[model samples]
Target chain A: MKIFELGKAKSPWILHYNTGSCNGCDIELLAVLTPRYDVERFGMLNKGNPKQADILLITGPVTKRCRERLLNLYLQVPEPKVVVAVGTCSCGGGVFRHMYNVENGVERVIPVDVYVPGCAARPQQIIDGVVKALQILREKGRALEVPPHLKKIVRGREGGIDRESLLEDLRRR
Target chain B: MKKIKVNQEICTTIPMGSQHVALPEPVKLVFDTENEVVKRVSFDVSYVHRGIEKSLTTMYDFKKAPYVVGRICGICAIAHSIACTVALERSIGIDGEVPDRVRAVRMIGLELDRLQSHFLINGHLAEVCGYENIFMHLWRCREFILDTADMLFGNRVQYDVVCVGGVNRDIDEKTGTRISEALEEIEESIGFMEEVFTRDKTLVKRLEGLGVVSKDKAFEYGLVGPSARASGVKTDCRIEDDWGMYRDFGLEIITMTEGDALARCLVRVLECFESVRMIREALDSTSPGEEIQLRVRDNPKKDAVCRNEAPRGELFYYIRGTGKKIPGRVKIRTPTFANIPILPHVMIGVRYNDVPPLLMSFDPCLSCTGR
Candidate 1:
């Protein structure tokens, strides 16, 4: 509904972090930014800084050393953000699962909203996952606008703000 | 000439990685700089270590080792697989028994892999130099190579074509014709890129005379791949090790004496033309309806070493078999591992701002190093 929220859905800047990937999914993600499969046509730009990113695209099975940094990056992104885990390793640790140094998948460290599955996930699959992430970003934007408990009082109003309902809503909380 | 006095008190220590915009993988570098010029540098490449060598000896058997090693570095998956297969075959005492057709098909796979990997690093190097237009154009042309690879192997990044005894897929006449057509398009684009890389003053200005590794220094540091070749080291596993059909194809090693970032870029661009020619020659030499794969019955009982010329450099694999399905020990020495040690040497006198391009010139693939 708000201008910033609309902008957030329209152009979702991506922050790509490779926990311990083989560079397969990472290159494919880069290919998505290039001419042939350019996601820039949809206003998607890959940003290096986590603070400016709307979505975090992560590849590779999380390694022991990268787990701390991954968490740090996940916390740095402001709220109303989405996490998309690309490649089979990030989804469920495809071949690197149960390895000594790896923590299996990105889900072990952070919450993931979309899982793009492939050994080195193809560019088309990555684009589809990103599109799905945009919808999730829009939904998150809507959810962040109003708290769940205050929704009843905000919607029950006829013409003016009801003091009794507001008071009751506060008491219930 | 006056030598400036060194001052440790004025030098600043700056850490540039683990995660950065200029780097595709996770590699941390600590630079000791005095005023803007670097005095010394050190790097940490353990971030991507997945214990693949340990897993190969303990968890996976010889039959499945090729597929497992293919995941070591996705950029050169075929190279890894071929090296692993060669090691396994040698350990089983069947190294010289493979048919010519299988070798030809495998060579095609490796050359195509080299073509795309060179394009990737060149495009990435241009991007780090702030030349996004050249980067975009180069990658746009790279799609044809990937398409040819996809047509041949049925996968883009992880082409699991190599096996222990032979390769998995054979190129039919129809696919071979299509690949030839694709190579023609790729060659035309490569010509355009070669002109830009050689003549473009701005791109050359950023890379030339930076990170000069003298010929003696290259041999002293034991640099492998294009980084060493750029210094005129004349070290290529394709020639040094007879794992593939490079000898039969009369492979000409590309070398440059400049030993700077520009020379490294030029070596890769020039090598692309050789890759195209090799692929064409391989396609012409091999025919359809030939046997692509051979059956393997013996388990490895001896130690064998296989060296492969990957897109980055020489990829070495040492496998010790204990007359069982699982190997006794599997050790991998990737080219990046050999090339990374030379970074501190190269980055010592360079400016702080030129570190990214200098680092990119080596084409550091930490996944291969750490694995």
Candidate 2:
């Protein structure tokens, strides 16, 4: 891991966007970040703008209207960022699954690095999910850090990106 | 200073939300301003609509409907759950037979839910007013109420404790004692916050006389909950309906006549004390030996309406059941649905930067509105 990867883990500024689920998961996320649970202890800052975000925490099952806004927000966060879906609804639509207006999970629109499952995912589970996201960031940080010639070689893998060994190494980390 | 009317011809428009710092949910408000003062305003509130009507009536079973209805708004899940359950029970004609103990427990859940919600909105009002420290303080104080909820119901955000005929969780002696103790601790902080919110010159200056919705205007919008009471309308659904044991506990309606943001804040703060009083009396009077869940065997064959005082205002649910496992029609008109329309009515004369606090003062919950 690059030395800067330590800084990334220590002070990850996170951006939160709600797609359309009932606010159960969103309030839990805010509670976990408060002084009582304090997600800041893990170096998380809940930034409002996507451009400054290093990790994106999204709640809600993507709805028809929010899908475009969700995709736009995901794109706005500069790369080396990892997406964490923070509730059961965001993971696979939970109670809202098969509803007419719901588009289901965030993964249907954008890649999710971690899925935190619960009706309104608990604060402890949210902290655990966020820690997992930081590990994914460390791997992406190193891969994106390589020079243009080496980056092209890494990006040319069979799946269009090299993450096969990185997953295994992350489990160990 | 002499009164001057700015020309509307040189106005510039500004659009806020769908996603913005001041809003937690998606909503768009376009303001047509003549320089700094807003001349005209419009709102778009359909962004959070997720086909709740379909889910409530067709997708979920009649018995499981309360849990589904609970998802309408995370902050006010208990209120929705209770309202939907009562409506279903009324249509089926079995709520009168529900045990008093179950109603008492349900009241505890409602009051605790009300306490936390009042804290959430009051603190967010402070946040939008740029008083981050007070926001933190109020929310930090709110954790006590949340912990009390976790003790009684199991989770913090969505309690999911309300069922069709009764409640899901039964309170033990141990938990009941703890709940009262937690409320005592919260009461101390509530006093301090009342002092802070009342005496803080900055908050008073920012909120006073801003977003003045007159009693007539409040009635014009059909405003519900604390919003209506703040406008000098002494109406509360809890007193109007005999759903819970509020009548037995002697729950008095609280109101103010100022019809401004500060009045709304003061009304909510005073009501929190009223809620605490009810909870304390309820814990003292009710013994915990009754059955929590009643076996409700009948299905609905008629239409019924249930109204409850959500922390924000009156939450009304209309359910039509046709003796089938699925409901025939379900219509949920949330408090925010009635309250958001009042935005354009009130914001037409306020300054631009005052928009966030004014909007927050109404406690806009777009998810509740659109759903």
Candidate 3:
């Protein structure tokens, strides 16, 4: 790892993806980044490109048609990533939970490290959720730096958690 | 040594969105360009569809429809809620007229909603033009309005402020005073931004002549809201409808002759100032302590169409109510859906690079379109 990797905990570029949301949560998510809330003070950047992002901030429920594109975006982001599901719908499809076209929530398609709950999550709650995501990313980054044999002893197993199977079970539920 | 096939016109394609920095909502625009001039355009606005209309009719009852409709478009939630409730109220036919206080409160919510939306669009258009400083300043100024909204109502975005018979919330003298002060502050700051937007050489040069839409083309494309008003349509639902308190308030329908991006921006800016004044006027005219709601004796057994001027344009809500608690069918015609037909027409003949700013000028909300 380069010496610059030490700054990973402070500066995490976020990828914001809207997956068929009503836009209530998406606008609130944007609110957290503006000067009023100023989440940028923590060095969090909203990077539209997934490939260059370190954390994925997803708003809205995972609609059937948008699931593939969303998953593709998640896969495009490099590893040592964290996913933060913002809003009630993004967590469990708040008002849009029962619509036929919706897949319920984003967690059904991707593993979520943190879930921020609100009809439209308040900017304060979103900023808190992002702060938590930053901590999780730091842990994931540290896990990547550790030797493979030591990683098992330091954490739990050879690998962290299988997010794909976890996502499948979440969908089944 | 290379052989070229001659005699054919060359056209290239540029796929713009679905998840772009310029557009917060999901929409994909495909532009067919001939040597950097757009020949045609196709839009994919289904990315934000979440079966809201189906849910409105099947899953939720009529009384709950207003709150549900508010979720359809976060930016226009207050407008949707007011329109949905008014439609139901018309169909239900309560014993007496809707209380004057209720109408005034609803109007305040709507005007506030439009205020924030206009501010947001102005900032977003600035951001799309790569003017981050102006975007930040505009949003910073908008925060006062959002804070006032949060103070008067409970939430910022999905304000469950409007209900079936009347509004779910009310404002006190203190909150009203606070809102007035906030509006004064906002107007001062936004006036500075309006000046900057008009006077800034780069912004003016980029937006002045680009994406020109003639009045004839605007009418032909069936444009609605600010997009149409910018082209001198001289049409607005509030002016035409006498059912609401707007007629009593006597608000003017603002229009401009130029149909370019700059004209649209000016329309939104001028409208923001007007909305602030309207809210102030509403505060004075409304009687205090009047009952905000009336008890409905029965469900609406008829069909009614409710139209409101949302931030982007005119939003039409068509509801067919049975004798039951649930509605039979709920059809929504959002402004973006009506405005989207003008997209290809406006984007044509403009450079490929101007597509983003031109599209932002209309401030198309994809959630409204798909829902």
Best by lDDT: 1
- Rate residue B229 of model 2 by lDDT: 92
- Model 1, position B317, has a per-residue lDDT of 90
Candidate achieving higher lDDT, 1 or 3:
1
Model 1 lDDT tens row, A12-122: 899999998999999999999999999999899989899999999999999999999999999999989999999999998888999999998999889999999988899
In candidate 1, list every pair of residues with a backbone clash: none
Q: What tens digits encode model 3's per-residue C-alpha lDDT throughout B1-371?
A: 12222246556767887888877887888877777888877878888888888997789888788878887888999889888888888788762478878878888888888988998888888888989888888888888888888888887887788887777767888888887888889889768878977899999988997788899988888889999999999888877754457777778888999898999999998888888788888888875655776776789788888888999998898889887888888899999999888788778789887888998898889888887
Task: Indicate whether candidate 1 or candidate 2 has the larger lDDT.
Answer: 1
Question: Where in model 1 is the C-alpha error above 4 Å?
Answer: A147-169, B1-8
lDDT of 2 by residue, B79-107 (tens): 99999999999999998988888888888
Tell me the deviation in Å of residue B26 in model 3: 1.1
Order of quality (DockQ): 1, 3, 2
Two-way DockQ contest, 1 vs 3, winner: 1
Superposition error at B137 for model 3 (Å): 0.4
| Candidate 3 residue A21 C-alpha distance from true site, Å | 1.4
Native-to-model Cα distance after best TM-score fit, residue B54 in candidate 2, in Å: 1.1
What is the C-alpha lDDT profile of model 3 across A1-173, one tens digit per residue?
54546667778888999987778778777777888888889888898899989889898888787899999999999988999998888999888888999999988999999999888888889888988988888788777785553443445534455566546545776
lDDT of each: 0.90, 0.86, 0.83
